[model samples]
Target: MVAGTSTALGWLLVLLFSAVAWYLSGQRRAGNKRGKLPPGPTPLPLVGNLFHLDPREMHRSLEKLSKTYGPVYTIHLGSLPCVVLCGYQAVKEALVDQGDDFSDRGAFPVFYRFTQGNGIAFSNGEKWKVLRRFALHTLKNFGMGRSSLEPRIQEEAQCLAQEFQGKKGVPFNPIDLVCRAVSNVICVLVFGKRYDYEDADFLLLLDHFNENFRIMSSRWGELYNIFPRLMDFVPGPHHRIFHNFEKLRQFITEHVRRHQKHLDRNNPQDYIDHFLLRMEQEKQDPQSYFHMDTLVMSTHNLFFGGTETTSTTLRYGFLILMKYPEVAARVQQEIDRVVGPGRPPCLADRKAMPYTDAVVYEIQRFISILPMGLPRAVIRDTPFRGFLLPKGTNVIPLLSSVLSDPTRFKDPASFNPANFLDKEDAFQGNDAFVPFAPGKRICLGASLARMEIFLFLTTILQQFTLQPLVPPAEIDLTPLCTGLGNVPRPYEFRVLPR
Candidate 1:
């Protein structure tokens, strides 16, 4: 009896130690271990704080979490550890000051499985350097940030205005019209020509892109990214994204075949022409990242970025104007005062039109599109402000936190253009206004997007005074959804000629 009792006590001690060790392992993953990393809400084993995350309003949820854990904190998605940087200071410190350390794109199962880390958006290190540099150079050469591209944007603005004019003051959903016009700009650059808005194939392609955006922004996408192995076999909308991506890939592949047939080495017409020329030039160089898959993926990246973000901003901008017609009136007044009523508004007019510029900035800030931003990864172990983020850990520079930092903005929650304006009514810019984000991974088309937004918004307001179907007070400015993209609620407005 004595021997048995002693053996039982020994086993009890061993079991107790094992349980304590297991608890410590979980704490380490949660960042709850003091001195190991920043503090955060404790995470459970395997799932790793999955229950704590709000799927739809992740940015808001994360913001709330920041309140509890402070600006820099860690949260686990499944087994993966992500260090989230909240507010302007934290994001600026990591992205701008320590750019090289946090330069790699974070791994997402969906993106990894689909893109295989091949494109500009997700590619890292040397591949990213080569592709991004070449893309910027080619885009600049083709008048992306130059005045040469102004005519193309002007043409599209005119076309878009014409489409709105056709509505004849009737309440209509302008999503398709805005999407087509904005997409054509990228189409012209990448494909060397723009298809008619009425074209079946063009609309079909847009639908595919739209569907992909919606799915990627849904909870299904988040779930797939977190628990990809299990989500793969699980029947749901998550699988549809793979289908959409494949279709897009097929379209790009088909385009590549046509581009090869009409290859022009001496004088390149567009992005496709430039890429093909580069591929040929580097055919003998085995070290070259220039290849067919890279071209296709890079082209897709340009298409995805160029279309979704800009077009959605326009879509959301119109919603904001309808929600606040007085703001729209002021913008129109500025456009008339600066550019006059006849000529199309140009990028040159942006400097002179302070009120209109403020409205544009305010719209972007209030919307805070892509709130969490495309996830970034630490290249190595990073000793952040009081936190030591491990190597290869996923980093989320909470862009919305910067855009709506209460310390910076007078009214962070409400839609107030004055947040971007001074007492003298001058367009006073805020360092926290990071719509295209900051750092080395800043949107490649920042200049282009800025020019597009300014020109498009001013031009539209120049020709039409937006009138909401219902009272402006009734229209909601809150985003329709908030997963991957902070999209505006679908609302219709009639365009009245100014």
Candidate 2:
């Protein structure tokens, strides 16, 4: 009996050693396959390249890595392999030529928790297609690109002017004013009305959304993506972020219910009304994706996308104008020559005021708010630039690299409007200038955003000359805190009346 027991123990030991050998052999084979990928910094086990990433200065860090690893490189964030496309050529190749293969957005854990694969931005497959199509159609019906919406934007712009006038030329942060104006534009489109700057509900919603944006771009947020199960148990900023998201969801849900009660099938006025009509139209279809949940999420996306992005861009526009007084003067001169103070500038005037138009384009290029344009996934095994991108691989298109490509722009680092102005003195559009991203998933609000930037900047420049309170050197152009967008540090300037 003792001899038999010893033999059995010996057999168990042999089996355990064989299993260990097989696992190590599999890891070695995976390592060999990874070796053929585009070059990048060597990663440590488990953590991969997590220690190398700095949440605050991620853009700068990525830019430096691009210098060493060529324009296309791969890095592992924990077990997930992320392929970074840098420079204009690399980004254009992945985002434009092969757009269909690379258009699927990678589902981040935190975003997935909030969005639940319902909204346009974070969704994929048939749901994303349906939501995106419905959103575009609904926005068009609500006068997005038509003349009907021009008056609404003008009204918001005028209200913004009045708010700034109330400042009495004192040095004050203009961020709030810009935020209110931009948010109201979406409010008019989504809810068919505008809110006063002091409205309690509006202010609360803004605070909640802003907090959510800030937290999503923080270190804690990154950690959550790495270790979701562990992070969920710990009380920290991620928990606060989830709380803010819940507040926003509740706010949107209330608005959606109100819209449903008052929706007019015959006269669908705003996005909510139009969506309600569509929901009824498709209610009988079992495969239909249009419903109250999606409507609420879509409205949430429109408000979040339309408000934060445009406002941040305009805020930076003013900061740039203040820093470069000469540029501001030239833009005002162009506006005066083409669009006098007697008339409010329209999108049509963009063609006439070439210099002013160039300045606006340059601001979008320089700011590059969405540095790492939303991550995309490979839906199927695909070949991207001679590299075998397996299905489910996450790809990141680096917008900062494209915006600041020295080969494309004359002086990419500096705020130079001449980059967009040709010898003929016309606003020259460059193929490399891709602020709204590219191809299929480009910003849905691109047309509206362009109009707002031109009209608002021209109107303000026509009325007042933006000047720094102190010397230009005193102005801080460095980004404040990296959020869902790049935000300028809070500063005050004197808006000298023209």
Candidate 3:
């Protein structure tokens, strides 16, 4: 009874504290409203638009708000007023046409707490630019987005297929297998080596990443991002996010230390070696972003970016293929016709296999991973669509809306490869297809992801036939969760050798 009373008192104190903080934040917000903001629904005191948003389907909820309040409008997410851009036209105008104006990384509390405004993903201003440029330059030198990396991906794809072959067409979850395979591709580039599939430590780290992604996509994570201050006092799975981040950080730090011991200033092997060299060169400059913390955060950003979305897309794509067997049959036919069974699928053959190419594009479009495309902040107070967006205003370019715009797609609800195919059955592209987003802040690993997805999916299909446990018509394509990324529903499937 005494413990219960203490807990009640604690809760009361927290509520009172939160109310005061909200009031102060609102007062600061009023002073910061530099110009006439876009029109939207009025928010209530303290809660803001929490009641209006369904945390589970945040992107969809925001998209629905567009119907009532035009394409571009403002919505309050717990004291923070965020400008949401819905559909292709609005998103394109802001992210593409007015790219510089909306180029800054927005405030994302879930990531901000861990990153602390350090990494390539969360950092803003000069730090973001320098780190991004250096990472891109180093990646290019190491063959990112180039044909030179194809062999590495192909080798990993074969290992993945061999692992599936060991399954003997039996029911087994391919989550770890696919994740290991995908992560290893980036692993080779970032760490300069890949761990054995049976390595317990590696598997545990992968599990942490998987679990973190799942939790961050859950409603708990959404709540954390919205009311970070209040949620810090609460307890839930969301706490695991920081725990996993620490584990990931420890792993990266160990790798960085190991690389430091074997430092090669002239003969750089991978990303870490290159970064270490840069750190040495810039050690004299006090303001250099090339430091230990940034290195770890940047590595984490690249490693996570390279691993999660591509693997999830492949997993979801496999489910879609099983759900629609005819699509699988047609892809395999194209594979056999173009590449033959002599070798694995390469980037070159993508042009010849238009159907397969279209399928890959359609899969990315259908899944719409990273639906909200990591929020953006306006760099300065700027005129936008007759409204003035103040400096540091948060904006959400709803990539989900762009991918599913009715004007851009014939039937946005259904998954169809024809969305990327022309009347002549040739591979085509759409302006609305901003899966990696548009403009300067696009995902750094976009090209690597494209190559990985194409190679991994085609290689798997060439080697085995995907068999679902349930009827094709009954296979569900809905995501298990919708935050962070569109997490595919987990299932076990059999893979038969072709």
**Among all candidates shown, the one with the greatest lDDT:** 3
Model with the higher TM-score, candidate 1 or 2: 1
lDDT ranking from best candidate downward: 3, 1, 2
Clashes of 1: 0
Candidate 2: Cα lDDT at 207? 80
Off by over 4 Å in 2: 1-36
Residue-wise lDDT of candidate 3 within 359-439, one digit each (tens)? 999999999998888999989997999999989888999999999999998798898999989999999999998899999
Please provide, for model 1 over 250-313, each residue's C-alpha lDDT reduced to its tens digit, 9 standing for 90 to 100: 9988999898998877777899889888888899999999999899899999998999899999
Off by over 4 Å in 1: 1-35
lDDT, model 3, position 373: 87
TM-score per candidate, chains pooled: 0.92, 0.90, 0.95
- As for candidate 2, its clashing pairs are none
Off by over 4 Å in 3: 1-31
CA RMSD for every model? 7.9, 9.0, 3.6
lDDT of 2 by residue, 92-125 (tens): 8888888888889874777778788878888898
Best by TM-score: 3
